[model samples]
Target: MAERDEQSGAAPGALPRRAIALLRRLARRLRPRSVRARATLGASAVVALALGVASFGLLGLLENNLTRNAQADAERQAVLTAGLAAEGRLDTVLTPDRGIDFLQVVDAHGRVLAASPNLRGRPALSAARPSEPGTVRGTWNGRPVREEHRQRVVQVTVATGSGLVTVYAGTSLREADAADEFIRASLIFAVPLLVLTVALVTWRVTGWALRPVEAIRAEVAEISDRDLHRRVPVPGSQDEIARLAATMNTTLDRLEASVIRQRQFIADASHELRSPITVLRTQLEVAQAHPDPDLWGELVNGALEDTVRLQDLASDLLLLARLDTAQTPPSAAVDLTEVVREVARARKGDRVAVDTEIAPGVTVRGSALWLARIVTNLLDNAQRHADRSVLLALRVDEAHGTAVLEVRDDGPGIPPADRERVFERFTRLDDARSRDQGGSGLGLAIARDIATHLGGSLTVQDSERGAHLVARLPLDAT
Candidate 1:
């Protein structure tokens, strides 16, 4: 069975499947690569198909009309001849009229009594003795005069004085056939020319329309990371290609902004990290050069503090990097009230008093650790700036469907102009605060970033006597 199957070349339907696959591959290879060429080819194919069908239809209609006319002429000629024979005025060699090719008269005994000049001395063209006048196909013998050709023959019977007789008339189809051939030849020559003209026009139009896209592509290809500030040219026309150029320019603008921001971030991070590292290194170097036991402890303490600051800055930088890239939303529900109370309680016994007025059961959906960090950062900022005390408050804004956390301090309030700038990384108000205060300047920035990641916002609002910072997070509906 295996041998027999192999001898048959392939399993049932497998050959057809292989052939179809080969054809598809060939089609793909033959397909034009450029959009303009493909458009031209597609348009040409459709037009050619339409023209071919119209030509065939035209030919069929023309052939049908010509055939009907020929049949009618033959019938009319037969009727006229039959009338003449009935009046006993028939001639042996009759003169054909009205495009009729031949005419014949026969008696009931199957004898040719009279005929047209072309059919003289010839036998009956057809033996059909139709009761009513009707047309049929026959051939003209043309024995002694004209050439043979296909004809439409119409026979009519009439009761004449010499018993019964039949009249035959016919018309040659040579003229109609010649008309059909001419039309067919003309169409065969014209269709391809028309299709070629259409293809050429389509190719030119398609290329013109795509010129803007090509310009955009070239501009983009010339642009690089160092030259992201450069923009693609926008066409004046309000078309899709114009819109595409505009969109490309917009994307370039965003890319350039992102690159600038990244560079600025790196510069700032390096500056921030350098401060603690420089201090620690200098302290170590001075202690090493002096080698004094008395000042060793003091030097070590200062070095440890610088090291701690370095550690904190590194951690803050890492957290910011994660927040920038993190896309997953916080899934766990956390009690905002508890987080605030916990942070405030931990901050007790500090130089500035920490106070809290948290509403119970104020819950939100976010990472609890990050939520605690928000409170911790806000409280730390407040403590560093407060004159005497820091107030932390958590409340549910039912109407807005949010949990609002506000931290306020009784210190010189932040100026309205610097409020937004304060949230930027490594920013510290020189008149109001200093680096000597042991604040990394990233605390508030990190707090704001966490709030944004959790689908919330943190901002400094108007306050009576001190800077008032507010954080709002959506409440956990579940």
Candidate 2:
């Protein structure tokens, strides 16, 4: 068989050895690359370290126990030999039934009087003081004992013709050393295999634990802003991974809603601008065809109206954009009462009966310009719709820590369903209402946005006789 293996170039166990090497290569290639790999490596290293330390400690303890047992047996036999020799029956103690390697009766001068069959006439096994009694190595019957061999001795006061003699009885360590070596060899193979088994188990457990996280990462990676409607898969496990996936889905939902609102805002702004642009173009075309001074005057006046409307719409759009991005309003105190008074005094209400109920010194923290715009929008909205009268009231509600402004007009009160919708951008209840009278549908929207930006709110209130609007703001300290 040896000759055939040499000829074929296939050593014993060569096929299995090659298979193991191939498996090792494949395991290395399939090793984890992400956090899972790191976890597996870390866990496996810890387990291997713990198991190795424990195995080494246990093996050392086993060796010590075996050696101690051997030494104890030798000591007991030595004591028995001393008792036998003291009674002058030393010959009966050297029987084949005795379990020891060598037995000797030596005089004080170190001469062997009686010995085991194998060392009948040899010198004493040991003469000098033992370094570690019962565990030292020495020669026996012209043969050298190994360092691992165990031995024990005792002094016996044996009766003799002239005086007393000391005898040494001991056992060999052949059996104990054999058992220890076997265990040591077994552990040398077993510890590494045990460590490898622990590592494999740790790797598998770590992979199972991180599977959900990897799935979430892959799913999230495929989502983009344009496809925000897509949601990540939530794991059924009630763990951090499940919560993370749920939070991600919720964030996507908000982003989708924001995108939809943004698209709507852009579409409305374009439509509003196109109206004025079309009207201006028509007037210019007519002026160009007429070329008369009186007609030119009318055309220019009409164009100017359209231009003013365009400028106002542009300004409102810009303001809304700024409010959208602003974190806080300007921190300046403005008197709501004074703001309302200024608007009431500047109005040219020749037909509408403007009634004012201004409470003194109602102050709030915000930009003066934005405050004035809020008051103006409320008053203008009322003036446009009121048939005969518009009531404006301002008061500081000391109990509520807020300043309030109320504007009511005796016009068609808004329906309960449309109250909330009226504050949306570019919303108009009556399409037939001329642009000059309705102004822009953005007035209420801009008013509400400014109020909200300044840490206040504008809302419609129930009114039996007219459309009522209320604005509230946090009051500056007294």
Candidate 3:
């Protein structure tokens, strides 16, 4: 209330109002996105990331296992060849068709000792070099050669007393490279299929999640001023969307009540204006002839009073209309205490002894003109009903975050049955609250409208002794 809004000519307060507008825009554009884009995207990213990491891991394991199998095959054959050397049949055992391109035997020195049939005319096998087991890549003659990114091979020489024997056996890295290409191609094709399937599932799930929002929009669109009693469907789930729908329905309920009252106000106002016009017309008709000289002033005065009533009814209706269309001014701090005192003092001449009990700094958010009229109308009603005493109460409830104003009168309180009826525009009670007592009947209507426009409400509080009107305004503590 007191700390609301910035100072005049200063920057406007920023908050949920702006944030809500942005969300509304996003909701509009990503109607699909809202349905599940966010959730689906999150889920899909997790799955995709997991898939990539797993693919790399799985392939590394497969390559390791396959390369081990290839190396063991070469070692087993070399062992068979070593046994054949003892059988004096080494040349017969180390033959073709065992998945080896060639076989060779070498000594410790750089001297060729053996060659396979295919490489007999090619470079001869040299003595084993001192190196760790690993694959190496380079150009073999004029042709390019590639080795495994992982697999390795080496041949160590065993010392015989007179010479050295080399066991040159290990898997070919070139073959491993070819097998890896085939494995990689398989993953490249399979991952897309997996991703595509996941994406489709994501789209479906997102749409399912967003169905409640769609239903709410449809229900809201169907509910217009003519049918404000209509409520948006609430989802059974106690999730965020369900909460949103419930809140919107509550808002619609309030809006519907306000709109209904506005229409009632229009109808009541029509009758109020029509009644006065009829009176004025009758007066003019009676005065058409040579009017009685004594009754002339009284007749004119009566017509003048009717004219004034018409003016007040019209003015009140216009104010309600404006309130319905008016936008809230950027937040402004206002003192309810000052407004109550000013309105009470202005109406003091009517013999209305106002027992004011406003806390000094009681405040709220609203236009000065609108808030002043609320006080004026309440005070006017109190004056008519009060025999000698009317009470004005204004206070800020810090706990509730609101400011309250109450006006009560002891003079013949409104009947229990008609208490709610008095606040209606142009609905003057048969005897006590008749227009004959100077009620335009729009006071309560206008007051309530102003209260609503100020983001508050006006209602009749239950009173055992007299009529009690309560107005509550939500304070903007921006």
Candidate 4:
């Protein structure tokens, strides 16, 4: 295999890389996907680690404290025995104190001079000798003594008739070790139980907190374009989840309004188109039935008129669709004064007398074609409804940073209540302003849409004797 690998020119670490990749893939697959489960597992791992560290530290402190106390007891016992030996009043057999486990006395020659009751004939418990200060303390494993395990031993030396004698006093570590074992066993049992409890609590709490989110998801999933009126359930907690629900409802409201507007627009467009088509079809059928050359000319003219109206309606619909999408930005700086004057000039010979109050050097940022279209539509609307005279005025409102264009006509003025309603597509007031007056009813709507697209506004304002229309566009600073 090695030879084959070498012949194949494989890298030395390829196998290890593949193994690591496989392990990562397995880990990803095994990882918990639910947020609640992940939170529970994360919290458990942290708490477990903290408890483990604290347990080890506690055990260490316990062992140190126990060893210190034991050593202190042993030192005190050894000192008392050394004092007895120095006075030459030592007993051959000594009784141990409540804390001390064993006591023994030896001379400079290592001869055992005294022993405790439990170690009557036992040899010296430790070979430790005192320093120049005549005292020493240390641990000793009780070897050759079948009963004792470990002890804290302290030796003290004294000068007497026998020259130098050493007293060895020791305390067994059985109680401290037993205490440590008991606590270790408790922690060993308790840590896992605590971690499990924490995991269960965390899982339940996280699930409870996310219940609102689940409800929202379910409600949203059931909602379709047709049912945009439905809203997500908002929790009463007034938390981030509640705010999210409110925001979702707001979005749904806007979506519902947009769907309604689109439906209305389609219906209106269909009705408008059907009128011209129906009229044209009727005229053609009449021409086909009569087959009279003299009447054919008038029929063809009427058919042509209906065809023109249909064409105009189609063009208006297409323009409105483009404006609705609003895919492009107005990048050109057009002179509002020029556009107004040019459109007013084209309507010089109209039935209604047209008058212009033009202002020069009034510039705005927008497409010239749309700007002209706004002016043309406003003029057309004014001329169609005007009794005798239509007034067009242009001026720069430097105080408001806008260019204002006003078109007023001496005609039946719009009612205050129906002022805004006039901007609706395919809307016509009573018989006086019906579709028979060569008006598509989209003139005002298209004008308003164009003004809006150019970051401007078009609206019907109060007039004393006739309709007053005003348009405002942002003035170009440059």
| Residue 274 in model 3: lDDT | 84
User: Residues 1-478, candidate 4, lDDT per residue (tens digit)?
Assistant: 5433556576677778989999999999999999998999999999999999999999999989999999999998999998999899999999888889888898877788998888887776656554433888887776534445578888788888867888888998887788898999999899999999999999999999999999999999999987899999999999999999999999999989989999998998888888889988999999999999999999999999988898888999999989988678676998778888888888878899899899899999999999999999989888888999999999989899999999999998889988998899888888456677848789999999998888889999888999999999999978
Clashing pairs in 1: none
Better of 2 and 4 by lDDT: 4
Q: Which model scores highest in lDDT? A: 4
Error of 4 at 143 (Å): 6.7
Pairs with backbone N, CA or C atoms under 3 Å apart (clashes), candidate 2: none
Candidate 3 vs 4: which has more TM-score: 4
Q: 109-227, model 2: which lDDT tens digit per residue?
A: 66666776766656765565322213232223324323345543333445555345665655665665677788679878887787677768777887787788888888889988678
Residue 63, model 3, lDDT = 68
CA-lDDT, candidates in order? 0.86, 0.76, 0.71, 0.88
- Tell me the tens digit of each residue's lDDT in model 1 across 1-478: 4333466666677778989999999999998999998899999999999999999899898878887888888888888888999899998989999698778888877799999877788876556555543334444444322545556677788888767788888888777778888998998899999999999999999999998888888989999988998988899998888888888899888889889977888999998888889989999999999999999999999999988888888899999899878679577989888878888888878999988888999889999899999999998888888999889999989899999999999988899999999998888888545678838778999999999999999999999999899999999999
Displacement of residue 93 (Cα, Å) in model 2 is 9.3
Kindly indicate the candidate among 1 and 2 with the higher lDDT: 1
**For model 3, the run of ten residues with the poorest summed lDDT:** 137-146
Please, what are the lDDT tens digits per residue for candidate 3 over residues 121-207? 444343336343222222122121122243333344444443555544444555556667886898798877787788889889778
